[model samples]
Target: MKYQDSLEQASEKAAQVKVFLQRAGLAAHPVNYAVCYDYISGHHAALCTAIEHKLSAKTPFDDFIMADLYSRYLTPANPQQEQLLQDASGIVSRLTGYTDLAAEQVADYLQQLDFSLLQLQQQQQNGENILSAVEQLRQQTQEFRSGQYQLQQQLEQANQQSHQLRHELEQLKLQRQLDPLTGLYNRSAMQHQLELWFTEQPGRRVAAIAIDLDHFSRFNQDYGSAIGDVILSKVARKISSYVQSSGLPVRAGGEEFLILLPDVDLRSASEIAEQVRRGVEKLRFVSARSKKALPKVTISLGVSLYQHSENWYQFLARTTDVLTLAKQRGRNQVASETMLALPA
Candidate 1:
């Protein structure tokens, strides 16, 4: 009878251990079977001791074994089995001084974990958005730099073209103002200069000297107009050279010249006119038709100074009057209104 009772008790313990292992999600196979068997044996010993104490009307041994189990593993239980053991401890400690509820604490702890997970998700999303914005900004900056570089290159090219065009325009202007035959100031250029000078303030002295080649029509008749043109060119060259070495000269008309002297009195202009007259009297040119030496070329000069009351047209007329007087007098001498008015 004793052996049969022991077998029955071992079978009951094995069945309870199997149920516990199933609930705990532990294997009850050959690998963990020894541990399960040992636990069941200990539980059976405690239960037998409790039954004996109950029969004797004494302190229950089952309570003592339960207190020991709680002390060993319930207070700070295994992390994987904490929820299961905590639930069981609430039921068992109901008859004891254990009013602290583990279920509510577990619920609160799970709520905190959920809130933390939400915050982590939001932070990750914000980081991704910031990275996208930075990439867009980098692309825009690169495009702006490319546009700026192209604009700078275009501006430099435009500036270079503008400079070259301005230089060409200046050269063209110089060519227009120069006489091709004698390299002197042309009639249009001299008129422009005269207009510019006359527009200034009053009492600024200005003199005009008119020069005519002596008997130029007869000379052109003797030789052809071609040789006459050569003589005229040589005469222009000589007059231009003399004026550049002395004063300013302009090719005012055919075989007629004008000199403008700024800041000069009538007496000084007359002296310069006389100098040009003597200079031309010394010049000689060869005739193109006969290939023979020609006589010396002579010029008649007329000089007049601007008055405060005179306009540009009137001043030019007075110089023409003086040239007519010089031509009527001899045709190879310098004459001025002031010189002609003096007593002989």
Candidate 2:
């Protein structure tokens, strides 16, 4: 009865989400639905407020509202923001090296000036020829100018190289978190975010939505790896977009994606998982070469909330177990830890 109620709730929200989009004069699109569903399910309080404000003002809604909502609700700060800050600061500190070199050069110039003054005094005291002294001074002045120019050129070259190296390093750090195939955050990125959520914010609630593509191997076998690759890319792209800012979307393994929702409970997490499932279900795939439609693809999701006492590994294991149970019960259904804990 509880399972049936959740499905009924999902069905109702899905309908309301579509109606909200239509009434707002927004196109019924994936990105639009992601925001509306989130709002309808109360996953995004701020979004709900924004929509209410527009309605209260009696202003006509436009695409700009969607864009604004997306930026605010769906666009999460980069999980690697702290690391990026450190990397950027490190790059900027390279300029300090140049400053130190410049200081040394200034000291050398001062020392040269003092030595020249001493030489001039000695030349005068020794009654040396004024013309010869003048010639020697001219030679020293030319050498000083040439050396200064050379030092300036070297500093400029060093600065350019430092910038290039910093850019390359930043790119490498971003790549470390990204899956090469699906363009989603890889396992390492998810672990990084989870560590931050786990250790930094001890009391905060965290939930995991574990997802796995159904009969993924069947598609690979029937259409070849190329089509399978396309399917994976499309699905990952859809999942990644929905979790853009609100959560961390990770390509946990082949045909499996995990979304980490910070400060969320099991109910909200399951709703988001269901939204993802429905979005993927509506996708239509057709082959280019043969001009034939491909088999419909679906996914199973398991949601589990973090227990204050259990570590993240245990939390993830429970979620994965829930996912296993979901498959056993029926593929393409959303199951939660609560469901798993129920008496059989």
- Model-by-model lDDT, in order? 0.65, 0.79
- Tens-digit per-residue lDDT, 1-344, candidate 1: 21243777878877886885575444454323434454456544544454355446642222112323333322333353454445445434542322233344445545655665565567677774445444544565565566556655655665565566556556656655666666677655666676777677456788889888888878888776787778778777777665643356776545778888888888988888888788778887775657789877889889999887866656766787788789888889888977657643
Assess the local accuracy of residue 339 in candidate 1 as a C-alpha lDDT between 0 and 100. Answer: 63
Report each candidate's C-alpha RMSD, comma-separated, in the order given.
58.4, 19.1
| Per-structure clash totals for the candidates | 0, 2
Q: Compute the lDDT of residue 179 as modeled in candidate 1.
A: 68
How close is every model to the real structure, measured as TM-score? 0.58, 0.66
Expressed as tens digits, the lDDT of each residue in 97-173 for candidate 2 is 66776777678767767777777788889988557656666776787677678768867876776777678677877
**Least lDDT summed over 10 consecutive residues: which range in candidate 2?**
59-68
- Candidate 1 similarity to native, TM-score: 0.58
Tell me the spans in candidate 2 whose CA falls farther than 4 Å from its real position.
1-111, 122-135
